[model samples]
Target: MIKAIGGYFGLEMSRAESLRYPDAQYFQSARACFYALLIQGKPSKVWLPYYNCDAMLGPLQRMGIDYGFYAIDEDFTISRALRLAPTEWLVYVNYFGLCDRQQAEVLRRFNPAQVVLDHAQAYYSPPVDCLATLYSPRKFFGVPDGGILVSNVRVGSTAADEEASHQRMSHLLKRFATSAEAGYADFQAAEKSLEAFDVSEMSQLSRNLLACADTPTVIEQRNHNFLTLHARLAEHNALAFDPSTLNGPLCYPFLNERNDAVRPDLLGESVYVARYWAECQGRCSPASWEYKLSRLLLPLPCDHRYTDADVQRVITLIEKGLKGD
Candidate 1:
């Protein structure tokens, strides 16, 4: 049976000459990537950061893998002083993609083979010699439902590509065509749809879109936008890091005493900023450093989508919001 030659056309997409991690395994979601690793290693216990989103606990709970919470210091370092058993792993997040130094310290202190580097926010940060490194590319790019896992652990290949990628595209397309306000409903729907926690291969649609990305340009733009924000607000920001170590950070995390008040003010002015993790408040005590970080850290937009002028506008609005103007 021969197929018709060029009968109809489909979506046209460009193929990139190279990808950041060409040999990395692709999964439907970051949690699925972690699940793949957990299933392979069968770790006896795992430790997660208390200052993280509850979504991360999904794979572990589903697999019946025992897990405990660990505390993060004001500087995002692991505060726990416990040694891991032979079959236990510790998950450390590259918080706001601004903790390379802390990540290096963790690698130095802990056994590299028992560490899980959650680079969900640190897409541009390369993987170190660890048990596994997981990345949720959707956080940084326009693609829908794709995750990258780099590790020595062989979670053999799969052909069962996720089928819901097209359905989840509504929000990305809507937001691109119109404004964020217009697409808010669809965005919420898209997010809710991914709660199923399906562990499958990355969908072909998402993989193609990711391959089409101009990664070099995006990285350059994101770094520039981040520095643009940091240059003006470094003195006021409580979270300190060397600007030289930054590599396409997720956002410029600005911590201030007035963050709780200014967040709503910025929203009122149509400048939406995201809180790191509101769920941490329910888990960690109010006086804990992690809880304080959850309450005051404003992850201001510094991705590749905006220009320097746009960032300056956000800075001006932040200043006004702080002043309660």
Candidate 2:
């Protein structure tokens, strides 16, 4: 499974057992964190990466927030920007589980209190302190709904009892009936309606699934599988993996010289590789598009659901696909 999904050095839970509410769930969804930040901070100007999910821009625009795009290096790290504006808010993404410690430090140096770390991808490895840290739980676990907005800034009172109950019920219903097709449909409907969907509504069943998350074991296995696949595929000159400082990785993203040509073969191997942020609104600047188009990112299943044998099978399929056999 790890080989199939390709998240060799990705995020995992810190604990196996679950909690009652916020404690149990780390981050909810990238979209949720995006919304929450807009609601809570209400900053005038924000800075984000050009190579991020397009879904994020909608909320920012809806909130009438102006944003600037920063340039990312070949390694997908944001090392340069046009200029440091009076940007009251700055959003930093922990891209693909690769934490850019230098960028974080730079942001702090400029304006310590203005940075918001979107740990949606690099939740497992976080800085000791920051103004705010956001997470998307579904990215790591089997939960249907949940997100955390950790901040030094406090908000007003909690949701009313009836409102909370109604939201919870709606979440449960959505969870019970959700399928890939249904989810796609829902997204289409939302796109038509111009209404943003909140991802914090997990069903009881989904919550139960969260209880089974085992962080340490998952991390160990994922790293092992990642190393194995990396070593095995290293001989293939046509395929190259992203070299990053990953304590844990969320996907094994690689650059393929023949990605457009070999895509069909990869799919036939049952390798459900993704273009990741291709459809993300205007987030894909020219540089972002060049990198994404030139690369094939594979998210290996690091969860407890997959075994070493599954990893080997995935690696074999990838090797065969690369060989054009």
TM-score of every model?
0.94, 0.73
Per-residue lDDT for 1-325 in model 2, tens only?
Answer: 4556664664343446754234322333456556656777788888777666666677788788888777666655566544455547777777666656655655655565777777666646655356677766556654445455666665332322333323333333453577434354543442332234453433444455666666676666666666766777666534344545545566655556645655676567655566666654344545454346434555444433557787788777767767777
Model 1 pairs in collision: none
lDDT of each: 0.86, 0.57
Model 1, 250-291: lDDT tens digits are 998899998888888788878888777989899899999889
Error of 2 at 298 (Å): 3.9
lDDT of 1 at 272: 84
lDDT of 2: 0.57
Q: In angstroms, how far off is 210's CA in candidate 2?
A: 2.6
